[model samples]
Target: MVSQSPPQSHQIYPDSDGKPMADNTEQFRWIVTIQQNLDWLFAEDPNVFVAGDLLWYPVEGHREICTAPDTLVVLGRPKGKRGSYKQWEEAGIAPQVVFEILSPSNTLTEMNKKQVFYDRYNVEEYYLYDPDKNDLSGWLRVDRNFDVIDPIDQWVSPRLGIRFSLNETLQIYRPDGRLFLSYIEIAQQVEQERQRAEQERQRAEQESLRAEQERQRAEQERQRADRLAEQLRRMGINPEE
Candidate 1:
């Protein structure tokens, strides 16, 4: 009789859920801004994990209970690539911070479900922003449950050290007083900086050239004076007098 192996179990959840990352340009812009800015903010820290639109399975062995936040930050987890965040594999550390950017397709029912899921999974800070309405909302974990933050405007994130401003449009500022920028804005700023640096370099070169020319002119004048003085000496006259 041939030896038979035991049946394998379905323990792996898929990396993607066949859903698009964003519904429209506005939603996609918010997602990219938050993800990129947070990535830059905590880049030097080895223990902070940041991801955008990645599937997060809060419970192990049950792939059905999973939700992908627009952007999520895990404080205790190591920074690396992950197909999906399996809570069991991450030392049972849930993501400390989560952000959701509202799209037109997002319904009230869906958002309520997300809130419950984040609450049940022990998320410390939850933020929701709607670009169309210029609305921002926040929930902080109070005791064992997540409670709504009253007057969400001008509220600072405890974990992120970033402040939210609602004037004109939704603006998020870093601790160092720099506002979060979209991909296009960041690219433009980089180009501007490059241009400024080039101008400075050109100015420095011009200054250097002018100094060299001045030195040459002074040397010629000194040579001319020396020749004149030598001629005077040949004529037995004091050039200095």
Candidate 2:
């Protein structure tokens, strides 16, 4: 009998694309802000998956056809740690939303390719923001093609329920109308809340102290009146009268 050879393993899909997550600090900041905020928004839901700068492979054996999105949101997937998002392994559910932050190093051609890739992969929503220029662009999938979102300013994402505003700068608001904040801004807010809480604690303590003092004074007055009444009674005077 001839020995049978074992089947070869499939292609390996690397987690990283060997590229930095962001070319500059601005790009990095936007990426983190969008990803973290989305994470916070869907924190109560177990079916939303949010990742930043993670490679995504849309095909099973074709690992070469992959790209790492700045921010990728998969609504139907469970929240967990993944080295890379393999569409085949994810119940064949493509990432529904994606965000890209433009840096000085990004070229128009490079961005165009990303758009094409996302469109072909069935991305429901695509948002591109250029921090330096304060320009924002969005694309929403219509049928099988992505349509350019005109008057993109103040455009609310159907899937994400987040509003994008481009006035002095790009501001993204959550469904609850909370503005997306950077890590620094979030830290500052936390510090302010902590200080406020401390002040409130101090005020409560002071109020308690004041109440105790008032109670003590009232008790002392009552005791003094009782002593005077007893002396009057001992001297043959009716204290009540």
Candidate 3:
């Protein structure tokens, strides 16, 4: 009989990397804005996956080789909840686009390391933004290397198809020319829409009430005219005359 080998143990990939998602409120806002907007943009597509601060393991059995981007967009992946992104389970497809929002605590070396990691892992587009300084940078993978994008201001991302405007502050616009709104802004807009709809409902109700009142008045007038005609006939007078 041939000797049987023992089954290998499965490796564990932890979801959390023991680091906070953002260092400050501004950083958090930007991260959420980018992630939520991307999620909204691809909401109709079942195959697009958007995640924020989710650990991604590019290699199996080597959980140490992982990096979590502030925001990541994967084109071919399905949208769902995942503890972490395991490349092997995802058909070896890597995230196509990634965004990094800078915080005060972020050092140059740390950002550079993130760039290298992204480049090595086949990231097609990489963008970084400093909200305080209104600075933006981007890179596109060309010829198997990360190429610096020139004139990043007002530059449209090929994958996302969104325009970037860097004036006194950073603003991102969708393909439909709508600004990418933050969570608070979206909430405020929803409230405004709700109020407008409520007003419209109230106006419709008032118009309907007025129409009913007018109909009632016309009916009463008809009844009075018929009564007068009957009295004229009873008095032996020609009602028609």
> If scored against the real structure, what TM-score would every candidate get?
0.93, 0.95, 0.94
lDDT (Cα atoms) of all candidates against the true structure: 0.94, 0.92, 0.94
Error of 1 at 159 (Å): 0.4
RMSD of each: 3.2, 3.2, 3.6
Give the candidate order by descending lDDT: 3, 1, 2
Error of 2 at 170 (Å): 0.4
As for TM-score, the candidate ahead, 1 or 3, is: 3
Candidate 1, residue 230: the lDDT equals 99
Off by over 4 Å in 3: 1-9
Error of 3 at 220 (Å): 0.7
Per-residue lDDT of 1-241 in model 1, one digit per residue for the tens?
9975433255658999898999999999999999999999999999999999999998876788999999999998999989999988899999999999999999999999999999999999999999999999999999999999988878889999999999999999999999999999999999999999999999999999999999999999999999999999999999888
lDDT (tens digit, per residue) of candidate 2 on 89-185: 8999999999999999999999999999999999999999999999998999998999999999889999999998888989889999999999899
Model 3 scores a C-alpha lDDT of 0.94
Model 2, runs deviating above 4 Å: 1-9
Query: What is the descending TM-score order?
Result: 2, 3, 1
